[model samples]
Target: MSSTTHNHTDASCIFCKIIAGSIPSMKLFETDKVYAFLDIGPIAPKHCLVIPKWHGAKITDIPDDYLMEIAPALKRIAIASGEENYNLLANAGTIAHQVVMHLHWHFIPKPDEKQGLGVGWPATKPEKKELQRIYDELKQKL
Candidate 1:
């Protein structure tokens, strides 16, 4: 991690304090763009959080550096979880039940014979033409 001082606002955000070194954590790894730490509350064995060094509520709001840092940090978490396969999850809006209001990816290791985190599967049915139209719109923007 670079020796850059971050300007974090202390607004009752655990992640902000974690980045600021104001809160104690079982640190796993740290980099200029992200932090890897054990989840105080774990949904699965060896669950950890891969949080951006900066605070942002949603994935779309995250800066490029933060987005780029995720894969490497996730690798570190996987190692901590005994290199077992893991699920990388991010809850994005109120409907998703994002509690912290900070963008953080959960690295939950799936060891063996356990049904991991469950999620609802919402079906979106559209015609081929509609799909093509949506793709075209996105491609045009890109």
Candidate 2:
């Protein structure tokens, strides 16, 4: 991450630079709204990233149209990677391990347990009443 802070349109954004062709990338596939490229430092073989052309620091900041285009492009890139075992991941903020301020998706090929994303669930069993109450609250909002 550079000293530049997150913004909707930033001149110092690396992903934006890639989208503008000001910086070189191992281009995989591109549409008018999205760009997919091989990650320079990959977690696994054929690891790649997909980003929207419009500058948005988080996924929620992206326009619905750009978000829609990104999903299919990532699917195509994942399928073309020639690895069935893979992980499709995205992070929204620094706390979520998002180093880049630009909104992007990671298509990481997980060949085995030793590679790709290593996840752990620090889960706790909540009381049934609590679960039901939470579900009801969300459902009511919906």
The candidate that wins on lDDT is: 2
Off by over 4 Å in 1: 1-4, 8-10, 112-115
For candidate 1, what is the TM-score?
0.84
lDDT of 1 by residue, 21-120 (tens): 7788988888888888889888777888888877778988877877898988887667656745678899998898899988989988766556456656
Candidate 2 overall lDDT versus native: 0.85
- RMSD values for the candidates in order, in angstroms, are 2.3, 4.7
- Put down candidate 2 lDDT per residue, 57-101, tens digits, no spaces: 897788898899887998898778789888899998999899989
Off by over 4 Å in 2: 1-8
